[model samples]
Target: MDGDNPRTPLLSIVQESYLPKTVSIALKCILVGLNIASIAIGVIFMNECPGQYLIPYYLIISGVACLLFLCMTCLPCVDEEQVTSVTLANLCAQGVLLLFLFAFFIAGNVWIYSLYHGPWNDPSSPEYCARVLYLYAFWIITLCHLCFLVLLCTYLCLLLGLYILKRSIFGSRSS
Candidate 1:
C-alpha cells in the first residue's frame, strides 16, 4: 500500500464504510452549531463588563475553524496524504484553541461567581440576573469545549494508532 493512503492498511474497513468521514462531518456540524448558539446567547445578554468580549471572540474563531473543517472534508479530491496532514494540523490548532478557551471560561466563571457574593447578591437585582446568565453561558460553552476536546482526543488516538501500525509494517521507511 502507498504511504499516501494512511487509512489503507490500518483502517481499510472503516474507510470503506465511511465511518470516519461521517463522524468527522457530524462533529464539525455540532461544533459549528454550538459556536453559533453560544454567540447568539452572548449577544442577547451583552454587557459592558470587562473581558465580556471573550465569549463572542472565541465563538467566532471556533465557528470559522469548524467551517474550514467542513469544507476540507467535503472536498472530493482530497488525497490521503492531504487528509492526514490537514487533519493533524487542524486537531493541533483546535487543541490549543480549546485549551485557551477552557482557561478563559474557567476564569470567567470564577469572576461571575464572585459577583454573586458581591454587591449583586440581591436576587431581584439586574446585575445579579446578568451574572447568572453569564454563568449559565460560560457553563454551556465549557461543556461544548469539553465535548470537542474529547472528540479531538479520540480522533488523534485513532490516527496515532494508524501511524504506529504503518511505521511498524514499513520498518523505518519514511512516508
Candidate 2:
C-alpha cells in the first residue's frame, strides 16, 4: 500500500533451507568423512605403490575438490535480499566444479577398470599394484556409481509425483 516501498518477491525472501538443518548437517558430515578417507587412502596408495599411474593422484585431487565444494556450500549468504547474488554465484561455481569432478571421476573409473586384472602385490612385476589399494579404489568408484544412480532415481520419482499431483488438481478444474 505504501508508494515509497514496493512489495517485491526478492525483498520478502526468507533464509529457508531446502533440507532440514539437522539432515543437511548430517549429510555434510558424512560427505566430509568420506572425502577425508578417500584422501588418506590415496596417500597410502601412493606410498605403497610409487608408480607412474595417476589413479592415486586422481583420488587425492577429487577428495580435495569435494572438500573445497563442501566448504563453499557452507559459506553463509550475507545478502538475503535480491535472490542473494553471493549465494547464487557460490551455487553456480559449485555446479561447474561438480560437472568437472564428475567427468574426472568417470576418467578415474576407466583408468581403474582397465587395469582390473593387472598384477597385484607382485613387486617384481612391472605392472604390480597392491591388492588392497586396487580393491579399495575399485570398490570406492563402484559405490560412487551406485550412489549416483540411487539419487538420480529418487529425483526423477519426486518430479513425477509432483507432476501427477499438479495434473490431478488442475485437470479437475478444467473438466
Candidate 3:
C-alpha cells in the first residue's frame, strides 16, 4: 500500500520544471505591452511625469529576471548538471534595471512631486538645495532610466548568448 505512492524527492524535483512555456510567452508579451505603455505615457504625460511614470521602468527589470529565471529553470544547465552555474552577471543586470526604475521613476519623481510648488522659486536654503539636488538628480535619474534601457538591451544580448551557448553545447536550435 505504501509502495503505491512512495516518496521520490528527485522525481518531484524533475517534475516541477522551472518555467512553463505558456507563462514565458505570456510574460514576454506583458513586457512588450509594458514598454509600449511607458513610451506612450511618457509622451502623453510629458508635463506631470515627464519621463518618470511613462512605463513603470521596474517592469523591465522584472521582465528580465523572469526571462532569465525561465531560461535557467526551463532548460537545465548544459555543462554543470548542477544548479549553481547560473551566473550573477545575469541577475545583476536585471537587478540594476529594477533599482534604476524604483529610484528614478518611483522614489525620485515622487519626491519632486511632494516638494514641487511651481516653476519659479528663490533658489536658496538647504531644503531648496535638496530639491535642486533632486532636480539635478533628474539627469542622473534619466541616465539611470537610460541605463535600464541599455540594461534591457543587455538582457536581449544575454538571450542571444544563450542561444549560441545552447547550440554549441547541445547542438540544439532555440525553438
Candidate 4:
C-alpha cells in the first residue's frame, strides 16, 4: 500500500466490522439505557449518604462520556483518514478514563460493603433498608464499570496488535 494512501488502520477496521449499522445502533441504545439507569441508581444512593460523593460523581461523568461516545459512533464513516485519528484518540482517551473509573468503582464498592456489612449488619437497624439499597446501587455501578472496562481493554489490545503488525511489516520491507 502506498504510504500516503495507507490502508485503514486495523483498529478502525475492527470497529467497523464489529459495529455495523444494526449492531452499532443496538449497542448504542443499550449503552445509553444502562448509563441512565446506573446514574439514577447512583443518585438515589447519593441521597441516602450525602457524604459519599465519589461514586455518584464518577458515575454521572461516565454516563455522559458514554453518551458522547455513542454519538461519535453514529457519525458517518465517510473518510477513513478523517475517522482514524479522531476515533483512535477518542478510544485511547476513553480507555484511560475508564481505567481510573474502574478503580474508583472497585474501591468504592469495597468501602461501602465494609461499612454496611460489619457489626451494623442487623436487619433490625432502622437504616438497614437504605444500607442495602446503597450496596445494591454500588454493585450495579461496579458492574457497569466492569463492562466498559472490558470493552476498552478489548479495543486497546486490538489496537496494540495492529500497531505491532504494521511496524514489523514496514520494518522488514525497509530492511
Candidate 5:
C-alpha cells in the first residue's frame, strides 16, 4: 500500500501476464513438433498439386490451423505483448490457409458448373461451356489466394517488428 515499498504484487502480475508461455516447455515442444509435421504435409500437397482433388489438402491444412489455433488459445494470456504478436502471426497464417481452402472449393464448383453448360446449358448437348466457366472460377480463386498471401506477409512483418521493439526495450532498460 505504501509508495516506499517498491516491490508490489502488481509487478509480478504484469510480468506473468506479459511473458509468453515460457512455462510448459516439454509439452510446448511436443505441440511444436506435431505442428511442424502437419504444416509440412499441407505445404507439400498445396505446392505440388494445387488443382488436384483438394479434399485431403483441405482436411490437412484446416486440421493444422485448428490445432495451432487451439494451442495458442489455450496458453496463459498474461504477457499481453507476446500474446498480441502470436495472435497476429496466427491470423495471417490461418487466414491464408483458410482462404485458400475457401477459394478452392468455390472455384471448383464454378468450374464444374461451367464445364457442363459452356456458354449455354442444354439438356440435349454436352455442356462444353462448363470448362470455360471452370477456367474463370479457377483463375479468380488463384488471384484471391495470391492477395491473401500478400496480406499475410504484411501482418507477419508487423509482428516481427513488434518483437524487435520488445527486444530493444528490454535491452536498453537492462543495460
Candidate 6:
C-alpha cells in the first residue's frame, strides 16, 4: 500500500512554491507584457535620437534578457529538488547573463544620466534626446535600482532575524 503512489514525494516537493503555481504563472505573464512595453519604448527612443543610442540599446537588451530569463526559469525540467545537468547549465547561464546585464545597466546609467541636464524640446541641438523616452528610461532605471535595494534589505533582515531566532532557541536549550 505504501508503494502505491510513486509520485507522492515528487508532488510534495514540487508543491512547495512560495506563491501558488497559478499566481506564479500570472506574474510571469505580466512580466512578459512589461518586457514587450520596454522594447517598444526602446524603439521609440532609437527613432527620436539616433546619436544617443546607448539607452535605447540598453532598454532592448535588458528587456530581451528578462524575457529569456523568464523562459529559462519556466522550463519543465527545472526541478529544484532534482538537480540535473540541464538545471546546472541553466543556472550557470543565468548567472553569466545577469552579470553581463548588470554591467551593461551601469554603463547605460552613466551615459543617460550624464546628459540629464540638457535640451528637452529641440531636435536641432546635438544633445537633444526625446523628453518622453529619456524620462521614461531614467525612471525605469532608477526604479529598478530602488527595487533591488529594497529586496536586498528585506533579504538581509530576514536572514538576521532567522539567525537571532536560532541563537535564542539554542541558548535557551543549553541553559
Model 3 lDDT, full chain set: 0.49
Report the lDDT tens digits of candidate 5 across residue range 23-97: 555556665665465455545544333233342354355446646655654544455466322344554665676
- The TM-score of predicted model 3 comes to 0.32
lDDT of each prediction vs. the true structure? 0.57, 0.77, 0.49, 0.62, 0.51, 0.77
Residue pairs in candidate 3 whose N, alpha carbon or C atoms collide under 3 angstroms: 38-54, 38-55
- What's the CA RMSD of model 6 in angstroms? 5.6
Off by over 4 Å in 3: 1-17, 48-86, 108-175
Which residue pairs in candidate 2 collide?
A: none
TM-score of 2: 0.75
Estimated TM-score for each candidate: 0.45, 0.75, 0.32, 0.53, 0.31, 0.75
- What is the number of residue pairs that collide in model 4? 0
Report the lDDT tens digits of candidate 1 across residue range 1-175: 5555655454443234356767876776776686677556556655533434454444444455555544544544366666433344554555676676557656655555555455453555544444544565557656757978999999999999999998898976755
lDDT of 2 by residue, 93-160 (tens): 88899998989998998778877676645787666667777777788899998999999999999999
Identify the superior model by lDDT, candidate 1 or candidate 4. Answer: 4
Model 3: how far residue 124 lies from native, Å: 27
Best by TM-score: 6
lDDT by residue for model 4 over 1-175, one digit each (tens)?
4352355566545464544667766877888997787677667666444334454555566666666656665545565566443456666766776676566666756655554544333556533434544665556655767888999999999999999999999989998
Q: For residues 105-132, what per-residue lDDT tens digits would candidate 3 score against the true structure?
A: 6654554444455432334432342233
Give the better candidate number (5 or 6) by lDDT: 6
TM-score: model 5 vs. ground truth: 0.31
User: How far out, in Å, is residue 147 in model 2?
Assistant: 1.5
Candidate 3 minimal-lDDT segment of 10 residues:
50-59
Candidate closer to the true structure by lDDT (higher is better), 1 or 5:
1
Against the correct fold, how does model 6 do in TM-score?
A: 0.75
* Candidate 1 stretches greater than 4 Å from native: 4-19, 48-84, 87-92, 115-126, 135-175
